[model samples]
Target chain A: QQQVKQSPQSLIVQKGGIPIINCAYENTAFDYFPWYQQFPGKGPALLIAIRPDVSEKKEGRFTISFNKSAKQFSLHIMDSQPGDSATYFCAATPAERGGADGLTFGKGTHLIIQP
Target chain B: DVKVTQSSRYLVKRTGEKVFLECVQDMDHENMFWYRQDPGLGLRLIYFSYDVKMKEKGDIPEGYSVSREKKERFSLILESASTNQTSMYLCASSRSRTGRGETQYFGPGTRLLVL
Candidate 1:
């Protein structure tokens, strides 16, 4: 069973526009939600993360809006640039695992910013 | 900065051959993970180790095995390489912490093609 599900297998947006990718989880035990960005020829890197305690968290042009009650979270890139075009993955983990048990990841969304 | 390195960026092997993929982390992190990334399946954990010689199977551990003889190194082995095993393999590392949030650093990934 896919515990975590992500939508829009691909996305395209113009430069300076906001591209939003969303994910949902069925496991309530999940408390840590993180977004990763992957550029071609490189591994996915930690872009931003959010805990269930917060409704939203922002870092630079990247923002994570989390709804614990809804068991959903979304990543938004502000002023999207061509450099930001890549694959994005959303992952979740339970706190009881202590961040050592690894994570459950979404299938990923391929984003493209048309310049 | 945490650096995770995979032994190879691209490797081609014949079916039924034994395969070994090595990963090394420079951050001395206590937690290391092995995952296989596919086009539409995202990233699925194969195995993870929290300490030397201690390993745990992840969601999809079938047809794969891992060894962690040192805190900074982890190895994934395929007893007999199969065409179905062709995919991009990623290594990740993180600090062992008892919490809900932790950052995972990933390697560039090794793309294996089994014929």
Candidate 2:
């Protein structure tokens, strides 16, 4: 079973436009939500993360909006550029596992910013 | 800065042959993970270790096994390589801070093909 589901398998946006990717989880045990970005020929890297305590988090041009009650989270890139084009994945982990259980990941979203 | 290195960027193997993928992390992290990434499947954890001589099965550990004789190195072994196992393999490491979600750093990834 896919515990986490991501929408918009692929996306394209104009430069400077805001591109949003949404994700939802089915397990209530999940407490940590993180977004990862991957470029071709490279592994995924941590972009930003959010915990249940906060409803939103922003780092640079990346922002994660989390809704604890709905078990959903979304990633928004502000003033996205062509360089921001990559595959983005949303992942979750249960607090009970103590951060050692590894992560459950979404199918991934391929985002492209047109010049 | 955290650096995770994989043994090879690409590899090719024959069916029924034994294959090994090695990973090393320079940050002295206590947790290490191995995952497989496919076109539509995203990243699926195969195995993880929290410390030396310790290992745990992730969601998809059916055709793979792992070893962590040392804290800095983790190895993923395929007992009998198959065409279906051809995919991109990734290694990641994170600090072992219980209860709090830690950021996971990833390597460049190894693309393997089985014939």
Candidate 3:
């Protein structure tokens, strides 16, 4: 049973266009939603995160639109650049402290910003 | 800066051989995890540990085992390597932030090939 599901295995967009990746979860207990970005050789890094209490959060050109009612979240990259072409993963966690096992991650989305 | 380091960036092993992958985290985090990433399978958790000598099995722990002898180190052991186990292995650590959130830090990842 995949706890979290992501759509569009691959995505391509113009250099200045916005690329959106969405994810949905079946577990309503999930409280923390985080997005990670992975380059070619490096590991996935924390790009942005959101909690269920907030509807939306923006940091610079990256924005996370979270809909708690729908149990869905999406990441939007504004003014996408060639540098943003990479793999993106969405993950969720239900742990409040450190007792729980770990996070549940979506498969992934390969995003390409065409220059 | 939180840093998680894996023992090797690339490794190759023969089938039926025992394989060991080590991970170390500089940050004094309470949680550490091991995951295998494939092309379409994304990141699947193998094992996790929250404290020294404490370990838990993740979603996929069929042929894998883990040891947490120290707080900063976690080791994943493959009882017998198989060709299907060839994949990118990633280690991550997370610390509890506030009361309801955690930020996971990942290593550079090790690419393993079992022939």
For model 2, residues A1-115, the per-residue Cα lDDT tens digits are 9999998899999999999999999999899998999999888999999998999999999999999889999999999999999999999998565678799999999999999
Q: List the residue pairs that clash in candidate 3.
A: none
Question: Over the stretch A1-115, how does candidate 3's per-residue lDDT look in tens digits?
Answer: 9999997799999999999999999998888899999999888999999999889999999999999888999999999999999999999988575434578899999999999
lDDT (Cα atoms) of all candidates against the true structure: 0.94, 0.94, 0.91
- Which parts of model 1 have CA positions greater than 4 angstroms off? none
Off by over 4 Å in 2: B97-99
lDDT score at residue A22, model 3, on the 0-100 scale: 94
TM-scores vs. true structure, each candidate: 0.98, 0.98, 0.97
Predictions' DockQ, in order:
0.79, 0.74, 0.58
Writing each residue's lDDT as its tens digit, candidate 1 over A1-115 gives 9999998899999999999999999999898998999999999999999999999999999999999888999999999999999999999998666688888999999999999
Tell me the tens digit of each residue's lDDT in model 3 across B51-104: 899988999999999999999999999999999999999999987434566778
DockQ agreement of candidate 2 with the native complex = 0.74
Docking class of 3: medium
Q: Tens digits of per-residue lDDT for model 2 on B39-89? A: 999999999999899999999999999999999999999999999999999
Which whole-number lDDT from 0 to 100 does residue A115 have in model 3?
95
Writing each residue's lDDT as its tens digit, candidate 1 over B1-115 gives: 8899999999999999999999999997889999999999999999999889999999999999999998999999999999999999999999875655778999999999999
